[model samples]
Target: MEDRYSAVVDLQGDSKQAAEFSAKNLNKNIMLEVENKDENELVDVVREGYLTTNSGFLKEDVNGGTCCVTALIRKGNLIVSNAGDCRAVMSRNGVAEALTTEEHMDGKANA
Candidate 1:
């Protein structure tokens, strides 16, 4: 079997208190439940992983919201899921590839 890897970044409200709370409650249930290797499964894993890692408190501001970004790398295949403005990108052979599209208030943005 090939090696599998995962990374997560959780960004909460613009205050230290909010960020702290968000990180503390970040769930990791998906990592403990995923087992398939298909594309849909990979996407589901990425989505659930992000949710699990970014659940917590938030601030009361227009731009101050909680967001999570997740990346899953299995051998040469890569999958990513993101919320808010968080982003994930991959580079191969000098070519840049977008792993996760950013979710911004303005719309989807490139990372």
Candidate 2:
């Protein structure tokens, strides 16, 4: 069986400081540990969104700020882990199956 794993962390905010800080911290926290499992593991994907600013105010705006982090661990065709608006799907025998659902603040939408 093919063993693979992927992770992604996305940070979005109107303030540059917030986005940069989140991205940096997220990246720093990503690491792999010994698990007695044999497979190729990839580092986490940390993505930072653009910054938003208000022309009227000279300060950073925190409204509508959003950040997302995802982790995928796979072993011998089996995947395991936590995820958040992220999506995972697999196709077998011409059928597609979703693994995880997105997390959103609105409670109605996925992250």
My TM-score estimates for the predictions, one after another, are 0.49, 0.33
Instruction: Output the worst ten-in-a-row residue range by lDDT, candidate 1.
Output: 54-63
**lDDT for each residue of candidate 1 in 10-105, tens digit (9 for 90 to 100):** 443255554554455433444565555565576566555545444323123322455555555666766566666566667899988877754443
As a TM-score, model 1 comes out at 0.49
- Residue 33 Cα positional deviation in candidate 2, in Å, after optimal superposition: 5.3
Model 2, C-alpha of 68: deviation from truth (Å): 4.7
Residue-level error in angstroms, candidate 2, position 39: 12
lDDT of all predictions, in order shown? Answer: 0.52, 0.37
Model 2 global lDDT (CA atoms, 0 to 1): 0.37
Global Cα RMSD, each model: 15.8, 17.9
